[model samples]
Each structure stands twice: as structure tokens, then as C-alpha cells.
Target: MRTLAYSLDVRFKPLFEVMGSLHAYICRKSHKKLDLSPSWAQQVQQRITPELSDLLDGIGIDGDWKLTYLLVHLCPGEDAADFVEWLKGMAAGDLYELMSPYSNLFPAHMGDFRDRTVRLFQQWNEQYMQHVDPEIIERLHVEAMKRKQALPASDPFAFVDETTNGLQFAPMNELKQIILMPQYHFQPINVVSYFGKVTLCHYAARIYLGDEDFLTPHEYRMIRSVAEKSRLKILKYLRQGPRSFIEIVRHMELSKGITHDHISKLRNAGLLTAHFEGETLTAYSLRTGALEQIHSKIMGYIEQGMA
Candidate 1:
């Protein structure tokens, strides 16, 4: 058997968090209110400066919208100057090619989208750098460093398991490198992007800036996944060993759609792993280290006051 080779690079980037925070602010209303604790959301909202508020309001869209994809491609470095330089260097055609996926939301004229997005990003960076507390950045950096140091000695896949709260997995092939970026506002949320030979995994850090409890996106899903009686039964069944779809459905006594939804939630949460034997047969088993990972996270939060 040929072994696969890959590398892991982890670091803190202020601009990455800035982009995520901007996205969160612009789409604040679209988020399920219950996803974030009411007090925490309100506290973050209160901290938004009047100028920043107006900036977001002015650029905001009416329905569900997100500019993160466009912003991420334009991100050049960890500073405002780097972003400006990157934007300035890009040709109009290149910008159009990048923004094409989201073109429906933008003007038919590519230049208009490029110019407007660049300006919004510039303003967003300025307001973020001015108002965001320095302490939050420092805390996130510390957490990133801890994860970077702790990950190298463990299984590469384990890094994704823990960092994403079991939501994602390491690629089985053609994965050259993994870059980890930690974010505050985007906690409990993991965003993955592929560029060239590397995979960018942006995940929520275990940093609490003194307002409300923070849960990794995976943790939130796990908690919610087992909240119902049916889902709990699914877990109990899977805990015993691998089972086929028919076995699960029959045991749970639920419709295929409902059982599938529950299984998907568990799988996404990293609690269950699916093995496809063939086109018609799939087996589900509890991920071996899943519970331990959650236990470690909870303990880390309690003992270290961070995730």
C-alpha cells in the first residue's frame, strides 16, 4: 500500500476573523436566533459601533445573502494594506471570473461588483480594526497556538475531528496541506476552502471573551441531534455496532426520511461514521473516539476556561 503525504499549518490571522465577523454582521438576521444565545448575540450587536452599523446597513441585502466567498478569495494577508494591494492588483476579468458564482446577486457589469465589494471590505476592515477589542484577538491567537502545538503529535484526521467538533474529516487523497485559522464570532462554525495544493480549514476557537458560553458548531449539532427520543434511540443502536439503513429504520420505527435526517445529523456531528459496502448497502457505526473527543472539549472548557 502506498502511504499518503500531507502537511498541517496553523496560525492566527486577524484579517480572516475580520472577514468572518463582517459576514456575520451582514447576515445577522438570517441566523437562527436560537443558534446563538440571546444575550451573547445582543452583547456582540451592542459592540457594533454606529459607523460600522451604518456601513453594514448600507451594504446589506434584503433577503438571505452572504459575501464571504467573494471576500475570502480577495483576502491577501492579515492586514488592511495587504487586502488593498491584492484588490488593486487583480484585473477586471479576474475579478469577474472569481465573482461569477455569485453573479446573480451582483450587477451584470462585473466592474460594479468588484469596486463595490472592494470598498465594502476596506471600510469593514477599518471599522473592525478600530473597534474590535485587542484582547479578543490576543485570546484567539493563544488558542490557535495551543491547537497547532497539540495537533502535530496526534493523528492528522484527529485534528479535524476535534477542531470541527467532529463535523469534518481529513481528505482521503490529494490533500497536500491543511491550514487552520481560528475565529471568534465564527465559533462552532467550520468553513473549508480549497486553493491550489492546500485545504483551508477555518474553525471556531475555544475562546470566551467574557460575554456568553461558546459552543463549537459540532458541539451544538451533537447536542441538538440527540435531543429527541428517536435520535437518542438511533445513537443507542449505533453504539452497539454497525447497522444497515433497513435495520435502523426498522428498529427506530420511523419513516425513511426522518431516520435519514437523524442519521445525517449524527454523521455531521461526527458521532456516526458511514461505510458504504455497495450501492445498495450502507453501514453505520459510532465513531470510535467520538465520545472521548466531546469529553475532552467539555473538560478543556471547564479546566482551562476555553474550548
Candidate 2:
């Protein structure tokens, strides 16, 4: 029922995908839990040189993932290559100034921050991004445009919430913009980034290139998600109320990685809702609407396809 004060800007900038590709590579190195297939992981491992591997660590990818927010706010246009070129002539002080309000970007560390970001992105652009297929970027743009057209002007926030699976945040009077970007690298999960008064929500876009041997229904994905014992247990725990991830970990007495994996799958299946303040996850709750429709969804799928 909550609505934004106004219709916010919903953009489909390719710059997000550019950064997402880099972030995805870093996740492969640090988290080792990417939803991407084993083949994708193996390909990344094969493509990475020792220098790129070391650079991923050296850039502190595992720390805060907000290093690219500066570009989000200040980039002159939507082109990724142009943004990088613009960043080349940017002074360290200017970079620090722009990034400081959103993060604790210090003047003392500005030079290294700028240099490392430039080097990291430059290497990534040459090694991988330049050869990216145009079709992938086109897919993201097409999805975003559809969502934008389908947006209900009265409750714009709902579109964001639905697109992001479960990312929710209270409306802010000071908020100026909300960006609904699409990313393919982090399939089946959402990435929400905060920059000053702007909120960037990056939802997953599945790459369906020539692999659509058959159609899979959302109901089927939801069924498969809860078919496992661990996921069902996680859902049961959330039945009571929303719980922070740490709280869920303690209550379930499971390792952090396993807990995260379960939550990610549940989120992807649209069975769970995640709330956030800034970039930090506040809590997670079950999407009772989806649960309530289990029978209807199953019957609908059967009637349409089987019956």
C-alpha cells in the first residue's frame, strides 16, 4: 500500500552491467558461491591471469562493494566506456569529494582509490568486457523498458520491490531517484546499491540464448526451491516473522555460507522478501502471497500444460 511521493526515474543503464560483470568475477574469487553454472566458473578460472587474480584481492572486492557508486552519481552519460574515459582525467580530490557523501571516502586514501579503480576497470574492460555480446546488453535494456512501461504510477515502489524479488526500503522524503537496472551476471538474486539520495536496484536477467529447449514455469521453480528440507526449514522459521540474516543463522545453527545459500535460493524463488536500509540487510520475511497461491499455481500450470 505504500507509495513513493512521486514517480521516480527508472533507468536501464549498461554501466551497471559493466560494473556487475567485474563484481561477478570478484564474487567468484571471494564468495565462491555464484549462482552461475560450474561451466561459467571454470571459464572464469581459466580466463583469469595471476595478475588479475591478485588485482581482484588487492582492490578489496570482499570489503565494501560501493567503490563504483561514485561513477553512478557523476557519470556524464550512460555509456560505460565513456564513463571510464571521463574517470581518467578526474583528480583524486574530485573523486574523494564525490564519493564522500555516500561512503567514508577519505581524502588521504583518494589517490590510491582512484588509481586502483582505474587500473582494475581498465584491465577488466580489456580482458573481458570489450568482447561482450551485444545481445546480452540488449536483453537488459528490453527488460527494463517493459518493466518501466508496466509500472503503476500510483505505487511505483511496488515495481521496484517486485523486480528485486524482495528488496524493500521505506520511502525517504530526501530521495531523488530510483534506478531499476538489469544485470545478468548475478542470476536469480538482486543487487541493491545506495548512492546519496539515489537507490540503484539491479535485478537478475536470465540469458536464454538458444537454450530454450522447453519452458519452465515460475510455479515449478518455486516448487523445486522448497522441495529441499533445508529450504523448507528456513521458510518455517520465517513463518513467525521477519528475521535478520545473522539471527536466522543462530536460530538454525547452520554455517553462514549455507544459510546464505538457502536464503538466496528462497529469494530467487520469490518465497522470501528482503528489506534493506542503505546497502545493509535489515530483515527477511516470507511472501505469504506466494505461499497462499501454491495450490492455484500448481493447478494453473497443470491445466495449461498437462490437462
Candidate 3:
């Protein structure tokens, strides 16, 4: 799971870093109101990974294997109370339907979904059973049982009964708060596309505006320049939300010395910010929102140097 988590950081950081840069530029140019809530942003960022993995590992099973696993797990006679409880807790309303006779329901797609669903489940279960450590699975089962016995009915951990309503038990309080945050207060836009544009303009400057001696075409392709790689690596972890330097090192397999140096440079360059939750270092992605605007303006200066 940590490997998958690291993979996510490596894959998406560059893009999100771009998002950050674009955000900064837009705020400055449009002079549009930006929330730029640092603490809230950090909180949301922290939740990105563990939640994502839970959804993927649990309900995102392959068609055939997962289907059979669901049938046996959810059906009337084949009931595993503990498994059902685990499913209920892990299955976000977005991912699965937790009505009686548990099932994984995704939004409609064209074609025969029934057979495809079955096959997907089968493959998922085979892989899951193969990949997930037995001890971990057993531990989850054990813990679930313990919680079931000890906790009260209203306690979030108790999944003894399932609810048909789309709302599932939120694993964390912060998540519940976020879900309940007023969408009516916020503007409606395609978030993915919005973030995408922010990323493009952010990186465009890094790739296109730098001095030729300092940043070559090959470095652009490989994202190999110290600043460039730092930029890429930082963004990847950030796409999953902000991470501390320690988390970044663990995920990127970067030496502490190099990681510290890169983070400091980025901080100086105004691409990253560190927030301490008590003594623990929590870094927030600042390149988005207002910081992106500064990046664009700075890049204009860099472009002038190139010229």
C-alpha cells in the first residue's frame, strides 16, 4: 500500500505543482477572490491517500473474483458478519451500495454490466487475496469484531447494521466536516479541468522560460534539473495533498540531505510551505491559489533573462 502511495506521489506531484503555479497566476491576473486557507488545505491534503487506498482496495475489486467474493460475503446464507462490517465501513457512498446483500455499484456504463461485474469481482478477489497480507486481513477482522462487541450502536465504528441511504459511516471527523462543507457557498466548475489548466501554465514557464544553460530540453523531458526534479517530486506528493519532508523522503526514496536541500530551495523559491501540527512537520502545497500567480510573474522575469 505504501508502494502504491509512493507511486501516486511520484506520478501526480509534477502535475499538481503545475496546478499550484497556475493558481497563483490566476489570482493575480483575474484578481478573483481566493480562499487560500492554509490549515484547511493541509487537512484535506492529508486525507487524500489513506482514503483513496481504502476505496481502491475494498470496493475496487476486479470483476469476476470480486463478484464471487461479494456474493459469498453479502448473500443471505454465506454471511461473514465481520466482512460485511468491514465493507460497510470502507465503502464510501461514491464507490459502493451498502444495502442488504452487499454489492459494489458504480455509475452506469454502456454494455453488459452484470457479467462484466462478476468477472471484475473475481479478478479483484484473486488479486486481493493474493496480495493483501493474511495477518493484516486477520487483524482487520479481529479488530472489527472487537469494535463490534465493545462500541455502542451510534458509535461510528459499529457497523452491525447497514444503512441504505447513500451516506456511509465516515472514517474520520475531518472527512465528515469536509463532506458537510457548504457546496452552495462555492462556485461550480470542472475541478479537474480547472486544476489541469493551473498545472499547464505553471510548468510552461519552468520548461519554456528558464535560461538555456540552466535548463536544457533533455532536463525538461526527464525533469532532471535539481530545481525541476524538486518541483516534480514535490508536486507528486502534493497531488495526494501536503506531506512532511520525512513523508516525501520515504515516498521518493530521496536521501535526507538531498530532500532537505531541495525542500529548502523550493521554500525559498515560494513553491512549498511547512506547517507544524504540534511538533510534526506538515508541508502544504502552496503553489496553487495565490502562489501560482507569483510563479507566473517570476517566470516572466525568467523569460526576460532568457531573451
Best by lDDT: 2
Candidate 1, poorest ten consecutive residues by summed lDDT: 273-282
Query: Over all chains combined, what TM-score does candidate 3 have?
Result: 0.24
Question: What lDDT does model 2 reach?
Answer: 0.71
Candidate 3 lDDT, tens digit per residue, 134-207?
A: 44334333433443354343433112111110111212212211101101101111011111101100111111
Which lDDT values do the candidates have, in the order given? 0.64, 0.71, 0.33
Root-mean-square deviation (CA) per prediction: 6.8, 3.3, 21.4
Off by over 4 Å in 1: 1-5, 33-74, 93-110, 168-175, 211-227, 240-307
Q: What range of 10 consecutive residues in model 3 has the weakest lDDT sum?
A: 1-10
Candidate 1's TM-score reads: 0.64
TM-score per model over all chains: 0.64, 0.82, 0.24
Q: lDDT winner between 2 and 3, please give it.
A: 2
On TM-score, the leading prediction is 2
